[model samples]
Target: MVEEKEKREDLPPVNFSMFILSLNTSALVHLGELPDPHSQQKKKDLALARQTIDILDMLKEKTRGNLTREEEKLLDTILYELRMIYLRVSGGK
Candidate 1:
């Protein structure tokens, strides 16, 4: 019944986790950690990556007390990993 409808592929799944995933992909791509799907080339752009991270940080800050435990964990984990990778790639910059 309702379960089948909920499982339909035509329905777009929208959620905070998906938002974080998109931002994470953008940050990774900018950091050259992920190959550019379009160009098939890995190009490091620390500045752009930093910008993406900052945006995530902003979301993290602004969404304080509003996100569920899972959302908070996902955001925190992503930020930590991305920051560490960014620092290493940018030579601790």
Candidate 2:
């Protein structure tokens, strides 16, 4: 059972921080901040960035009262920074 849980997603040791990092990476890519590894060019996609931010907000809402103090803090911080970046990138659109 433990092994199954660990290997369920083939993700290798998933954690809250990893989830946040994944979302951050997506948002950065959408904001044209992260260069594509293959093409080495930034791609700006505001719609996708908004979607990613919404997903993070959903996680924050759904996990309320279920996360550790540090997890909550980290989530909030990540969301805030991402929101700010999204706004800046989209010109408050």
Model 1 lDDT tens row, 1-93:
888876886656878999899999999999999999999999999999999999999999999999999999999999999999999999998
Between which residue pairs do clashes occur in model 1? none
- Report lDDT (CA) for all predictions: 0.95, 0.87
lDDT of 1 at 86: 97
Error of 2 at 66 (Å): 0.7
Least accurate 10 contiguous residues by lDDT in model 1: 5-14
Residue 37 CA displacement from its true place in model 2, Å: 2.9
Off by over 4 Å in 2: 1-12
In model 1, what is the error at residue 65, expressed in angstroms?
Answer: 0.3
How does candidate 1 score on lDDT? 0.95
